[model samples]
Target: MSPPAVPEPFRWTASPCGLVLECRPLEGIAPHLFTTRDAPLSAADLWRRVGRALDAERVATLDQVHGRDVVTIGPGAPPPAGRPKADALVSIDPSVAVAVLAADCVPLLLADRRSGAVAAVHAGWRGTAAGVAISAVEALERRLGVKPRDVTAAIGPSIGACCYEVGHDVRHAFEAARHAAHLLDRWFVSREPGTGIRESKRLHLDLVAANRDQLVFAGVPEAQIHACGLCTAMHLDVLTSYRAEREKAGRIAGAIRCRAYNPA
Candidate 1:
């Protein structure tokens, strides 16, 4: 069966810094948005602006090691000595916003409706193969008794299969990571040559598909997960693509803050 069509496209909204992309499902639950390339501010200033827009005291960021490490922040949680070396950050504190930065990689924002918990996840190829998204869902469950089914997720722009071509090394790495065979087939497809182009043998891996499937596997309802389906390489005017831009590429951020505490 073909993959589900992206339910909705992310829209550009005037934000505190400049224009940013907001996901409707996540926006209804809490303060959240995905940064775009329209803004000319430095990376540090952009992050600060995002935090201010969300009404958060400060934004908690991760070191993003491209692995499955997940860190949780909440009451009594000690301050991180420096940036924590994790790919995902889960927050149950309403005053703190968690953010993840990406260029061609996927930046995912998740929110738990019933508990007001939130998470920001960064999943590059290695991180997706390692199941960082799933780790974040589990972190929410383990830390605040939030169920994955109650979580709503928004997958931000990234390198789509249309522009992302990889060699056998990436395929072999996923297999080595022990992903199921069927999923490997669905996420990785052989590229077809186009008009005036030679038949390229490289495989195209769908990072969004891989991460979305992992979220479902972790128990998030399929309908609650929204993907913008924008290809960073295809829309450089509004997005950033590390693969397409190389050393000059700027980062895109997905930021979300936890909901205010209300004693049950």
Candidate 2:
């Protein structure tokens, strides 16, 4: 599907998608700030929107599969079908706008200001269980020699706990992966607030919390992790959701790009 066209002199919206304002906290970063919604945008509108703000011709995006794959952006890229399979992409190059598309999955943006490196990740329950956030951070450190402390992150909107109902299979997967059988208890919900919720508890999985915990575990500063706490299922009018609307709904893309240093 083609992207929405964004006119020149763009306006940033908190949107139901829950974007962030980090580079210039008071005014926001780059050319635009957003997470995707079911909102229809033409190709010209979309590219024109991102390019004018980023001074580039297009936004780079990935085909997400809810895994821990990390792809570093370099020269000589292929089209969407031919690009390497990965849930995340990082780059020091400004020309590549790290982007990911999702519906009810978490979209994450990270930046190491000191190194001028940026990344965008697609995290779902499967990816979270697979430790994709840590994978992305580790990739940054291993591939580019960046410190977690220097990395600031924005956890964009997704299916929140209030609406992210999950099954025992999902919980068990994460618990088994982390080897912290206790973490399952910390993240689940039940009929009664204090009751043991192992088998009987119907849980609302907090995707943001899961990713935030990973960032913390990876040594990202507590102050630097910003979470947009909106639930895609709850706000169907603005954002898209596979859980709420199923295949009837379309997908929204999350994007971030490197911009030239401005002396403002």
Candidate 3:
């Protein structure tokens, strides 16, 4: 159950069960990790183990409808009967951890340094178009009294622009969603029809850039955001990719817990 070693900015931690990836900046903010494909367990088992390893009383996840909904978790709040249909989970309860599962989509983790609130976001292209990242940041500020400038984000592995070619329909969706024109231009890289032996015009969406920009737009400093920049499609040795493995793909999770559980 050992994961292959990853590169700088991301270190792999080994244990009896498997490996999890941690980044330095976010490591200083909270107890968090991005799980790998090397774990020899079902997704549920692995997530449970993640909660235990972080010493979290419980871990909260979502049904991930790929929308902008944000769910807030607290120790005193009653647990819901079913997983909430949302793309993001936020918590100020230090005993509770928040996590998001993904294969090709981005698993983004956010932590508030001043307030010790954390959020786990699942941002696919659809979620990105829907501004899910901005929603989470705003939720932290509105519900937990955390400022966007005080939040630090870790953008996990997912499909990268290098391999995420899209058709005009995808571009049209972003436009219809009302993302700023400049951002659309930057995120969607284009290749002319006759260039590079290709027969048609192509566009590639940079999911990382899109989400990072959205965070900055929400008032999180550009310097405070950290992107693993590892593409799930390219790093199949340790990561999972639905686009690469198709029906056989397993999911990876980004989980985070507040450093301590003080409710004062």
Candidate 4:
């Protein structure tokens, strides 16, 4: 079957810093965004921008080790003394926003519609192979008592398969991780001619597809998942792309905060 139609739940809006992609499905339910290259110069600056856009006071982020580990921020959870080394963050506090920074890797934002919990994940090729997306979903279920079916996810722009050619080691890594063979076949595509070394024939891995499938496998309804379908490499004017810009690329951020609950 064809993949779900391109998600229409996101809207790009101009901000003081630049443009930010907001997930419409989570509007009013949460404050979230997929930041663009024009975000800010530093993390502090970015948080300030996010605060202005979302009216949030405090934001939490990770060191992003490109692993499957997920950290949870409960209500009133204290800020970490330093950034934690993890790839994903989830929170139940409306006062605290969770964010993940990325250039080429997928930046995924999720919200629990029922409990008002939220998550931000950075899923690169390695993290995707390690099931980072599924880990975040399970973290919400186990830590926040969120039901996967009630969660909505927004996949931000990343290095699309059109430009993300990888070596065979990437495919081997997924295979060694014991991911379903058939699904692996679908996620990794053979590189186009003249793309990579002619003799070796590199592969292009779909980080978005892998993470989306993982969310589905973790119980999120496919229809509820929205993908921006914008490739950072192809749209560098609007997004950052590590692969295209190499070390010069600035990182984009994806952030989400739980909706404040006013007890009647």
Best by TM-score: 1
What C-alpha lDDT values do all the predictions have?
Answer: 0.85, 0.68, 0.83, 0.84
Stretches off by above 4 angstroms in model 1 are 1-9, 40-43, 78-81, 193-200, 262-264
lDDT of 1: 0.85
Q: 2 or 4, which is superior by lDDT?
A: 4
lDDT of 3 by residue, 1-264 (tens): 455454566788864237778878888879898888866337457756887878887778789898999988865664454699999998877777888889989999998887777899999999999999999999988877788988899988899998898987887899999999989888888666455312447888899999999999999999888888888898888888888999888888888988853332
Winning model by lDDT: 1
CA shift of 190, model 3, Å: 1.7
Q: List clashing residue pairs in candidate 4.
A: none
Comparing 2 with 3 on TM-score, the higher-scoring candidate is: 3
> Which runs of model 4 end up more than 4 angstroms from their true locations?
1-7, 41-44, 192-200, 261-264
Q: Give the Cα error of residue 262 in candidate 4, in Å.
A: 9.1
Local accuracy of candidate 1 as per-residue lDDT tens digits, 1-264: 222233464566788867778888788788898887865436557767888888888888888899999988865784365799999998878878888889999999998888788899999999999999999999888878888988999999899999999987898899999999899988888767562112446889999999999999999999998899989998887788999999889888889998774422
Residue pairs in clash, model 1: none
lDDT of 4 at 78: 65
